[model samples]
Structure formats: structure tokens, C-alpha cells
Target: MQMYNPEVLGVSLRHIQNRQERRVCEVMTAELADDEDFCGCTLCIEDVYACAMSRLRAHYLHRVSIVLKRPPPNDLEIREEVCAAIEVVRLRPNHASVT
Candidate 1:
């Protein structure tokens, strides 16, 4: 989870936060702006959000490559599946929501 670029994950998490409820990705894929760091520009906010959506799509389908360098093992995969897209939901203070 910590493996992907921070800009990608941070923006995605923020987008999920704006949604109606907690979500877990069935697939997750990361996308970048054709122009580097275009995500930082307010004018391209929608583009940034779309990039995040791309990542979310990748996870829901169980192809979580955005934040992982290699495929995860069974236990980790199960964990990701169970906990995917949890950004929209707040967890207990001790729960570290974004594991």
C-alpha cells in the first residue's frame, strides 16, 4: 500500500472522502496526468479525480498494481480484498483506517 507514489494515493483518498460512503475497491489502478503533477493544479481537479477513479477501478477488480510492486501473497491479497477502498469510512482512532 505504501509502495505507490504519494501524490496518487493521497489524491485518491481525498476523492473517496468526498463520496457518499465508505468504499472498497474491487479493482485498483493508478493513472497519472499526461502533464506531470497536473493533479496539483486546481484547474485540473476533475482530471485528478478521474485518475483516482482509475486506481479504484483497478482494485475492485483485484488487480491492485498501483500501490504494489509485485503481486501480493494470499493472506495479503485477502486482506486487501477485505479492506479495499476503505477511505470513505472513518475507523476507530486506534484502527489506522488506511492500512
Candidate 2:
């Protein structure tokens, strides 16, 4: 039996990351920037980020991969997820209201 070693294959395991993360962050940033009412506290922001990431399908990839054959999620879809996440966090924020 042979054990799989990414290092031997010239690929680092740490290089693996969800491709959707970048898109999600971009969309979320835009959405948040436009909404002045949304909480800007650390906890609220973190919660919204986590919630949005959870709802979207993860497209993981190795940094070494040259091409991504599959198309990424639609822009509208990502916006919808980020919007919903913001609403969820706003309605039931974990931390108390901050002055």
C-alpha cells in the first residue's frame, strides 16, 4: 500500500481553498458597503461572513491547478446568499446592541 503525499507530488496540501471564497467576499463587500444600516461590529461582520459562506456551495481547488473547467456560481446567486446572510445576522445578532 502506498500513502498519498501531496509534497511528493509537488503540491502543497495547504494550497487547497474554496474558489467561491473570493467571489463571495467581493459580493459581500459590495452589499455591505451599500447598506448603511447593517451593523459594522466585529461579531456581526463575522457572523454574516460565516452565514454567507455556509449557504453557498464550496468550489475547492488546488492553487497549482491551471484551469477551472467548471463555471463559477452566478453573480445573482452569490448576491442573494450574501443578502440573506446579512438579514439573518441583523435579525438575530449574537452580541448585544453596541452604542
Candidate 3:
């Protein structure tokens, strides 16, 4: 399956968002950037992202006003999940090798 990008579709779905997803994306990007040995291919990156996202709790905010009232996710938790995801994808990547 392909990763979803609303920007690529030229559409915005800003009405609702899983707060954990944004955190996962940020943490995953930083973690992978620091790991030089890890495969940064599209498949690997998407796998890592998917893996991380699945491990985190989903906190959906349907309105911008609610976002301000909600407590943000813990940074340490996000880091831990992202790190674990990195290892999982690294050990068992979907593809044999990057082209």
C-alpha cells in the first residue's frame, strides 16, 4: 500500500487528525536521520512510519479548539516507540535491498 499524503492529492483534511501521527512522523524522521546505516528508501521509511504509528495511542482532534485543550503526548514515549519501530523495520525490512 502507498503512504497517504494529502498535500500530494492537493486536498486538505485538516478537520481531524490523530495527534500521535504527527508526533510519530517527527520522531521517526529524527531517528532515521541519525541512523546512517539504516535503509532510508521509500519502502523502509514507510514501513518504519507505519510500525511506529501502530504502536502509539490515537488521539484524534476533530477541531482546532480541542487541540489547545488536550494534553500533548509524552516526548519520551514517542521516542521509545519510534526507536523500537526503527529496529523492527531494520531487522525485517519488506524489500531485500534498496535499488
> Candidate 2, which ten residues in sequence have the lowest lDDT sum?
3-12
Q: After superposition, how far is residue 93 of candidate 1 from its true place, in Å?
A: 37
Best by TM-score: 2
- State the displacement of the C-alpha of residue 93, model 2, in Å, after optimal TM-score superposition: 0.7
Candidate 3: tens digits of C-alpha lDDT, residues 46-80: 99889888888777776545536546668998899
Per residue, candidate 2 scores C-alpha lDDT tens digits across 1-99 of 586545647656756777778888898888888788898788888898899889988777865665767666788988899899999998899998777
Superposed on all Cα atoms, model 2 deviates from the true structure by an RMSD in Å of 6.3
Go through the candidates in order and give each one's C-alpha lDDT: 0.32, 0.83, 0.81
Q: Kindly list the per-residue Cα lDDT of model 1 for residues 28-64, writing each as its tens digit.
A: 2222223242223332333333443444323222233
lDDT of 3: 0.81
What TM-score does candidate 1 reach?
A: 0.19
What is the TM-score ranking, best to worst? 2, 3, 1
The 10-residue segment of model 1 with minimum total lDDT is 18-27
The lowest-lDDT stretch of 10 consecutive residues in candidate 3 is 63-72
The Cα error of candidate 2 at residue 25, in Å, is: 0.9
